[model samples]
Target: MGKSRHEKRAAIREHKEARRDRCESDAYLDANSRVIKAERNIPWWRR
Candidate 1:
């Protein structure tokens, strides 16, 4: 069965949190800004 709206929203929230944590870890490890932005799916104009 398909997930309900609330379930889908929760999943999205969890994914965002996970990505944020990864970005922070990458920053701590001296990962490139471009690479971190790419992971967060940020575009050029947004920067």
Candidate 2:
């Protein structure tokens, strides 16, 4: 199943927090953000 609303929000929030922390490398953050986008767009049934 696709991510639930709570899961999606959590993932987005986690990514935002990571960006704010500035601890991880830019490449890592960029890749993570891309993953969020990819997962977020998936249809529930398809997931």
Candidate 3:
């Protein structure tokens, strides 16, 4: 069966929260600013 609209939105919200937490925890600790900036410059579609 297909999920209801509310369920879909809740799943998306949960995923976003998890991603935000992960990004916050990393916070440039794993890589330097130059590498991160280069990554950011790339188009999302290419990535």
Residue 23 miss distance in model 2 (angstroms): 7.1
Tens digit of per-residue lDDT, candidate 1, span 1-47 = 99999999999999999988987786665667667767687666887
Judged by lDDT against the true structure, how good is candidate 3?
0.85
What does candidate 2's lDDT look like per residue over 1-47, in tens digits? Answer: 89999999999999999877786788878999999899989998988
Q: What is the lDDT of residue 27 in candidate 3?
A: 56
User: Residue 42 of candidate 1: its Cα lDDT?
Assistant: 68
Ranking by TM-score: 1, 3, 2
The candidate maximizing lDDT is 2
- Pitting candidate 1 against candidate 3, the one with the higher TM-score is 1
**Model 3 C-alpha lDDT per residue in residues 1-47, reported as the tens digit of each score:** 99999999999999999988887666555566768788899999988
* Regions of model 3 farther than 4 Å from truth: 26-47
Q: Is candidate 1 or candidate 3 better by lDDT?
A: 3
Q: Cα miss at 36, model 1 (Å)?
A: 15
In model 2, residue pairs whose N, Cα or C atoms come closer than 3 Å (at least 3 residues apart or on different chains), thus clashing, are: none
Residue 11 local lDDT, model 3: 99
Any runs in candidate 2 off by more than 4 Å, and if so which?
A: 23-47
Model 1 lDDT vs. the true structure? 0.82
